[model samples]
Target: MHAPVPGHVPADRVFAFNIYGDPRLTEDVQASYQSLHRDAPEIFYSPLNGGHWMITRYEHIFDIVKDYEHFSVREMQIPRIENPPVFIPLSLDPPTNLPYRQALMPHFSPKAVSAMEPKLRAFAADFIDEVLARGECDFVHDIAARFPVSVFMELMGMPLDRLRDFRALADDYFKARTNEEIGALGERIIGLMTELVELRQKEPADDLISKMIEFQVDGRPIALGELQSMLFVMFLGGMDTVTNVASYTYRHLAQDDALQARLAADASLIPRFVEEGIRSFGVINTPRLVVKDCERFGVQFREGDMVLCVLPLGSRDDRRFENSAEFDIDRQALTHLTFSSGPHLCLGHNLARMEIRILTEEWIKRIPRFSLKPGLRHHSRVGTVIAIESLPIQWPV
Candidate 1:
């Protein structure tokens, strides 16, 4: 059932699109989102999720995300909760958010990510090897989910033994419904992070967490609150986004024999393939709080109202991408809001790209041919992140 529309929202602008549990997401997530572009206004209000605005067009999303002055990042979640979990830099607006983001740049920089490529490649190959002999496997669970999580665990110095536990928590957090459920899961996550922070404080190690604990923001040592917030966001990013993207992209490749052969034959095209895949199957829905009453994008946005930037829709916006729906590896000037844009642009994009590139390169090098097991209908779940819940594929033994 839809929530009552607010007085400020025009009747034409109200569209009951539920970002979290929309039925169409399970059938075809990207196509489900694309329908909004055809059916709804560029910017409309959704009576679901406590009545918030949905920004479908690319230009408007770009402008709103960058305009921190107008659209604040303070309360990003829809169906607004009391005292939501804090994600450092992400939840903080510009100027205030800048220093924390700057401190993180060197760590996630192209150079730093390059340094980790060997380990990333090894992790990818190892996971591939585990499933390669079987000739049939659930790609999403067997490889897509485990690979990046393992790499992230190694980077953060988390124990491999707890990989499943941590992954489960991350999964639960995303799938959680209701404010209380989300909050409870968030606290449990923070509880885990708090332990790690305390342990790192006592025994400093050569890891991302230890390095971050040493970061100084505004000429002062980062406080515990800020440190926990940074780690919290890192945990979420490290665990989920890449996994979803990998599943979606591979599912696409599994269906298209020609595209799979092309990438397998020419490893050089793998990078372009990664870029195009991310653009085509981008999986993040970022929300922003309308800071002050404003008249922009030809609509009225009241203060404290939440606005969700439908990021995947932005990448597929025809105004920016020619033949945006078609997945063309040769598409030139391929820029997208997949990693978002502006001050809060995703910090881990370099690592995410490298992980996906290496994994694809390794998979194609080994299992050069594979496809969805016949008659298999993969399941998907959509929330802040859209994911293929299961993907069974097979190849010649």
Candidate 2:
């Protein structure tokens, strides 16, 4: 445990332990972000893990990510790893990342994702109908979480029954405050993935996992350990992220009747609104290592130094937009760093958009009006990825 350096986060703010715990569930996270921006402009050091620099400014973060040569994603802390840690394509730098990414791109291409839309929309409709019939429900657990997790499972050919288990494992692994807690959950997920990988190897199927099993580099298959890590990363990353985006977007849209009505009236605008929602609800801005001693935002950093980039803050940067803080669905010429900027930009971005688009459209078509309960409480967990535990909303029959 690290102590906060007096004035570490600026005079106006107090740090919230779970800023990423479940981004949609917490209110204090916004306060912490505001404090960092208003008082500590360039960077604020977190007391977590003896502290690491958290960059909130837009240009500062963009500059860092854009110049991959300066900031490397390699060597990032992955919950339960020791010296000479396990790293996958996501954790790899340029040349190494390029091949694996190329090998996988054909699977997530525009044509490929477009082909998935019909199946995804069918899934979305069924998911929405389940909640709409109830008249009221916990959006996160019942609907938001279910849709993406199920879709990903179908895409990956994982047993749909294990969706809840996977979520539980991922939540545990990500929200673990202690190393022991993380290790216990992480090892379990690895075991499960390993079993699935072995089973798929024995009798291949027409799924993403099977495809990975079939993919080769230099006339040999990609290693099973790396494949398991890759799949695990995809599972956890996609599930919580889509869930948070859905929950936050619902919360934000419901709060402003005018905005909600606008979206409800114009279904065509749902996609744009979803993009803005993702931007505003920007979850994780993971850390990157300073490959070599370098100066960023005028601050000198050592070779092995770490830097945290908050995507939401960067999305709300005034330098990038006319009004960064204000939410504008119709805001033309909007460019946000929520998905990040660079080679390591989210690979699932297209799929994420498709999921959100299908979800929002189907949701509005069914339940066009809703509001938060008078005294609903939100639960947020801030970790490497921010998430929403539950989003409670109500609608008429």
Candidate 3:
């Protein structure tokens, strides 16, 4: 039951923006995010997606994310879910969430990500090599889509041969038009994960699945159901985040010759470029369940309403970062909530940075200059994680 929305929030604030189905989400998402903070308050109610509160400012978002007791991450779905799948660490609160996060931390820390750089670079180079001679190719398919999926498959102990097939399924899963379609894809993904899990039980390898098999939470063996949920989160994240990030970032770079040339001449600046790119173009509106009645940020949040913490808008808040709209690599405050904040901060952040950095370094090194094919704009869809449709580009042979 929703407590009455405070009288302060006006009916005009009910903007009909649907993050999942909006075409503008992929086209000019930056402008779209800015519109939230344009004339609206820090938080507003959007009746779209069956009614939810949209958090528009960085300070407000940070507060709610830090206090999970009031704003629970358990129900992350936009439209919300009944008996949602419990994604460990991500879905749990406080002490219970710590151990699961700890078990996975070592693999994604800076040290581990650094160690994997060589292989990651090789993967990036090989992907770039495939399309260098063509002078024009779909950057999404040739590099952005495949490279991360390859690494994701390795990390999860899935077969590399299924890379192409998995990409197709992931695209469908994120862009599904109906609930039944989403359900079918979910079952298929879970089935594959189940097969991998069962295989690891009999024959463990030196992969994440093997480690999960050996991990114990709460001083006891992790439950199968819990383990599956963790894998499910990994499955969604692994295939989604970097794919859109790389496509969008590189697509931007492709169009900006001066920026591309600058990065090409001095590769050391690639990290800053990655940070700025994420800060500028990051897309992902995370949802949290209102566990109980509470008035936060001068807004009345009820027990059952969903609060969407729009990170892209929050990170770019001018109060936090001056000149927040423009992508300035040398910006004094480059930090952002692109991966989110607090206990639920993304553990995959280091790995994601590594992927984007390597791909940028290698792509610029090979094809130092490129641009979108004539008038072609890369396509994308807004959903779970915004999926980049295609990034076709051309350069001098």
Candidate 4:
């Protein structure tokens, strides 16, 4: 049911888009978003989720993300919660966010990600080997989900034995329905992270957490709250985003025999394929809180309003790209907002790209020809992030 549209939202600009529970999403996530581009106003206010604005066009989203002065990252959740869980740097703006972001840059830099390529490649190979003999596997559970989590575990120096438990928490966090439910899950996550923070405090291992603990932010020692918040964002991104990206990319490849064969034949094409796949399957739908009264894009904005930048839609904007919806690896000047734009642009994008690229190269090398398992359908859970719930895929032995 739609909430009452606020007076500021013009009658023509209101759309009943529930980002969390939209039924059409399960049918075809990309198609549903494409329909919005073809049908809805460029900037419409969805009455659901506490009456927030949805920015559809790439031009508008790019501007809003950069204009943090008007569109604050603080209190980003739709249906705006009271005392929402802090995600640090993610939830901070400008000079304050810059320090923490800078502290993290070196670790996720292209060079840093390149140095870890050998180990990452090994992980990809081992994961594929585990499922190769079966000739069929639920790729999301058996590989896509585990690969990135394992990489995160190694980086954070977390015990591999707890992989399943941690993965479960990450999954639950995304699936949560209400503010109360989300808050509870947040506490559980923070509790788990707190244990790791305390452990690094005493032992001081050579893990990412240990290095972060030692680094000074803005000429001052990082406080405990700031540390946990930063760790939370890292854990959230590291554990979840790439997993969904991999699943969606592979699912696409499974259907496109020609595309799969081309990539397998020429490994050099995998990087471009990865970029195009990211563009085609962009996952995140991030929210920005309006800090002050403003007006733009033929609409009026009130202070404290929530604006959701539909990244997937923006990347698929027809005006921005020729043939925007199709996943064409040969597409030139590929600039998609899958990693977002501006100061709050995704910090872990380098790591995410490397992980997906290595995984694709290894998968195509081992299993050149594969497809979605016959008689099975794929479904995705749409919330802050769009995630494939399960992906059953098979190949001949």
Between 2 and 3, whose TM-score is larger?
3
Error of 4 at 273 (Å): 0.5
Put down candidate 2 lDDT per residue, 241-265, tens digits, no spaces. 7877777777787788887788788
**Each prediction's TM-score versus the true structure:** 0.97, 0.91, 0.94, 0.98
Candidate 3, residues 1-397, lDDT tens digits: the string is: 2334445457765656677765445465665668767766668887767678888788998898898888998887777645565777788888779989998899889998888888888888998898899999898888888998888888778999988888888777767645567678888988888889999999999899989988888789988887887887888788878888778888778878999888988999999999988887776878888998898866778788888888888888999999888778888855588899899999999999889988888888889989888776656677546656888889999
Off by over 4 Å in 1: none
Writing each residue's lDDT as its tens digit, candidate 1 over 1-397 gives 6888889888999878888777555556886688888888889998987888988888988999999888998997778888876789899988998899999999999999999999998999999999888999998888988999999999998888898899889989888877889988888988999999899999999998899889999999999989888888889888989999998999889888999899878999999999998998988999889888998878999998889998999999999999988889988966799999989999999999999999999999999899999887877778678878899999987
Local accuracy of candidate 4 as per-residue lDDT tens digits, 343-380: 99998899889999999999999999999988877878
TM-score of 3: 0.94
**Which candidate do you rate higher for lDDT, 2 or 3?**
3
- Please report, as a residue range, the 10-residue window in candidate 1 with the lowest summed lDDT: 23-32
What stretches of model 2 exceed 4 Å from their correct place?
3-32, 78-81
Model 2 Cα displacement at 220 (Å)?
3.1
In model 3, the clashing pairs are none
Taken over the whole model, the C-alpha lDDT of each candidate is 0.89, 0.74, 0.81, 0.88
